[model samples]
Target: MSEILHSPGVLALELSPGATPSSFTLGREAADALARHIADDLLRLLPAERDGAGADQADLLVLGALYDSVQLLHPGWPLFAGLSELAHHSQALAGAEGGRIVAFGSHAGAMPGDALQPLVSDPPSPLLLVPWTFSAPEALATDLGARMESVFMAKGEAGRATADFLMRTLGVRLEHARYLTRHDLCALICSQLEHAGYSALWQMLEFALLYPTRSGEASTARGQKLVFRDGAVHCALPVYADWAAAFGAGRSREERVTDYAGWLFELRQYVALLGAHGVAVRFDGDAGATSLPAQRLAEPDPSLPPPTLFSHEARGLGVVVISVAQIAPDRRVRLLAHAWPLDQAGFDVGLPQFAARYGASEQLVRLGGIELDATADDLAVTLPGPAMH
Candidate 1:
């Protein structure tokens, strides 16, 4: 109760075991881009407080296992890519104070900072560690760094039980147990981008080298031009060796997997946010295998219970997240989409604005409109701004 009410702060990053990451500073643009990408998803995992004036509205700390995992996956890309970036969003989140980080369950990834000094040029910053295990307080302290102090301790199952205990002891009905999918994670990234105030230069790929802008200008010094190719929309990367660092290129096999994961995560988030906000939604197929009847979506009501990880499979053929959102400058709505089968990322789902195609993006647009873009594969239309709100 004291922890939930008094310490209205959230430590939302994922953690994993690892050594110190190589030195690299986050660029202002890239840092802002990364922060914008993950904000909403991080907020979702934090505690909420409706009755108090500023009860549940705490800044989120997107640190931990998943964050550490990304560094391990792309060692060359700096450690904790978004912390410095998120610090810019200090008005909303705690940024990188370190001490606010809370650990529940196992923290197999945490390494003592002092030990990494000889190998790592700079160690991780200081953090406030809180452990919620009356069950295993010592292990929790050790994970947070041996001298760490736990803000609260409780005895129960790992996740929801801990949350419930806070609710019971704190006297606040904290939003119940919720499961987040890769889809929601991606959408949060998109949401954060929208929130970050970048109305122009945008991130088309979550883990990519090229993030295109709204105009004819190039995304980096490498000067990659915006071009539509292979049904995937992008600002084509000109030289892998020539403009390597700007795009995070050279790490090919890993980046290939990144596009698939990043796009899929962003897509689901786009669909849910659009639908919950009252945008009309229609799945691809009719009342059968693929699509659901067109309808205004229900706002996520905690009183009705929540969904699990495997829930999407029960819906069949999978839904291509399609919606028209009111993103920057447009008081009205612009279309957005992430059809799983389609290879495109960050498309202007607002098809009437851009030219057409015979691809799945075209299929989704046709559901909302009449004609398709000309089927020339090389022809890609340039959108005026970032596809964010």
Candidate 2:
């Protein structure tokens, strides 16, 4: 059993768009160049801490993969587990002399994906990381960890030559290359998501990542509820009552009903974020008085376009269909909401035709197999276009 190191660090690269290669992976030459430069950087950062023989500073092993900019979910557990394992292996092989560096690079191509899915993101975010571990005596490791963070924060720029080499080879416009502990990375991501109006979503994600063993709960601005436990997210979709409490306060009942579409849009946005994180979302149907039960479908019903929102002129709004893939069949089941719109074309016109003309019906989020209990009579409508506003 390889134990996780007490002190793990990361080299942070802040990249701006500048004709950068689509992939984040560095080939043999680039990877080797990066490793050498990182070694030099570490040497300069800690000149006093040489190995026992005083021949080399420490063992800094950089992983071959360049990791994509992740949301800092789970601090660094499974995300950086492989790096920890690699360091342990190297130490065992070499008798454990020094610290290790685990690097994660990326390219839009053949590189393996992490626990987080959608390996390839459109318009990649402006960040990349190289994770490393510091192996030393407990006292020295603690002191070194504190020093490493401050050193990298203040003067952790990559060597000028290395930065130039990377810019030319990777084709990314350079912003600033520095170092940060995993804690720093977590705070950075939290701030970023908060600035982007995702504070509520971050709360749940952070809890899911950091508190995997404990049960926790979170809610969206629109009153959608989420419970995290047993390695999955259980969501209780807001009913008309919950929706009204959030958005219908001052407005008349009719006006609130008319604006119901706004709530549906918000729900879709939340679902999309969960899917993007590859979070297994289980719609909790029995928690509230509203009986909105959801179950797993053997396969996606091709007849219906993915998970969509359907609306009609007279009916105000129709159903907000939601579908999520089956992640753990034994412990959990996926969810899908089924509902139809009210149109003059009558029930005979069918959702397919009704969606084509009156309601443009946009697919909200599509994952895997899931089904909703048809008991909820309050199916609403969806607007046109797929993008969440």
Cα RMSD (Å) between model 1 and the true structure? 22.7
Cα-based lDDT at residue 60, candidate 1: 30
RMSD (CA, Å), each prediction: 22.7, 11.1
Residue 145's lDDT within candidate 2 is: 64
Predicted model with the maximum lDDT:
2
TM-score of 2: 0.64
Worst 10 residues of 2 by lDDT: 367-376
Top TM-score prediction, candidate number: 2
For candidate 1, give the lDDT of residue 355: 18
Summarize candidate 1's per-residue lDDT along 166-234 as a digit string, tens digits: 334323343332223222333444465457632111232332222222213223222333332232223
